[model samples]
Target: MSPSHHGTEPVFDVTGVTKVYTSGEVEVRALAGIDLQLFAGEIAVLLGPSGSGKSTLLNIIGGLDRATSGSVLFNGRDLTDFSDRQLTRFRRDHIGFVFQFYNLIPSLTAWENVSLVTEVARDPMTPDEALAMVNLTDRMSHFPAQLSGGEQQRVAIARAIAKRPEVLLCDEPTGALDSKTGVIVLEALTRINTEFGTTTAIITHNAGIQQIAHRVFQFLDGRIASMHVNEARIAATEVEW
Candidate 1:
């Protein structure tokens, strides 16, 4: 049976999800019966240390990985039941991903790099529009090598959002940048969430970043340790690294 749908439902409803990896004789359980809900148009921060299963869950929700057991419901549809091809389609149509590493093509200009996704996207914004959203319109003609680390990352963000994915999953997006640059990146993400009403989930080990989230999920030892809502959320610029 599918999850019950309601008038106001979460974009993602993850229930009893688990991931177990087997390597020879060792069994590593990355997630242990995780039950979580990500509401629409809200920013959620998954705060945890390395190997705490935050990224594991994010991958599962983004259709990049599957749960070993249990179900992941996206808009009331079970993603766990989707085939590989269906998963690819789901990701293409509904999910955007960002990571710590800025994976920009060195040979392409920022505009060209973002255009790569816009070309195939069903209903994507123009590359110029995406770059403007990330405050990189001025550097759109520059190549990855010509830009700073933060600029390259913003270009990557423009590429991700160019496709206009409903959900934006970011894993350690600011892990490699300096505090100042990280704040700038955070501001871009916040602006995207606010302007486009994108359902954003950001995974970070930095506790200070949680202040910007509408909800915070703390993970430990492959499980959610606690969850809380931010009654007094702060701006991304005010986050203390």
Candidate 2:
């Protein structure tokens, strides 16, 4: 069946996608026929061990990488058909990414770092609004170095969501922080997903983190080993790491 006929059409429709890389004489299959769908206004977590294709899938969905075979559709448009320039525009206009390292500029204040993307975005929220959403409004004037690790990550999240992108992709967003700090960051992420209604996907190795997701997919050997719906997702603050 075509993806459009699904009960709720997915924001991301990945079908039988595969990615292979060759290092000298050795070839690695990073993704082995991944078929998944991520719907709107939901938090989906991809859980897996290293090299299990979690990041690979995220990259493909974000249009940062291409698959060797099969197709990925975003809002029903085939991503495989987009040219490089088109892909760039698509990513810039429709997707937001948050990484584990909290890649904020040390020289810039929190507001400034968040505003950088707004300056170039076609339509964006004010830096104040974005910072407020992440609970960093009071620290808007603080530089990355001046903020705590969790705060820095919050600033990164602010920067990403400032553009009001349709999709938010997080790659182990709390990986660099301690468990307590990570929960704070996750709380901020959860707030964003709930308030903004952005379709969100997070990649993580932390099984405990999955409790905060509306749905979870476990990756094994570069394929989806299991998928389960979470009827009652605990708040990030309530979940133990």
Model 2: per-residue Cα lDDT over 94-161, one tens digit each: 99999988888889999999889999999999999999999888999999889999999999999999
lDDT of 1 by residue, 161-220 (tens): 999999999999999999999999999999999999899999999999999998999999
Model 2 ranges with Cα > 4 A deviation = 1-6
For all predicted structures, in order, the TM-scores are: 0.97, 0.96
Candidate 2, poorest ten consecutive residues by summed lDDT: 1-10
Estimate the TM-score for candidate 2: 0.96
Best by TM-score: 1
Residue 103 of model 1, lDDT score? 89
Candidate 1 residue pairs in clash (backbone atoms < 3 Å): none
**How well does candidate 1 score on lDDT at residue 43?**
91
Best by lDDT: 1
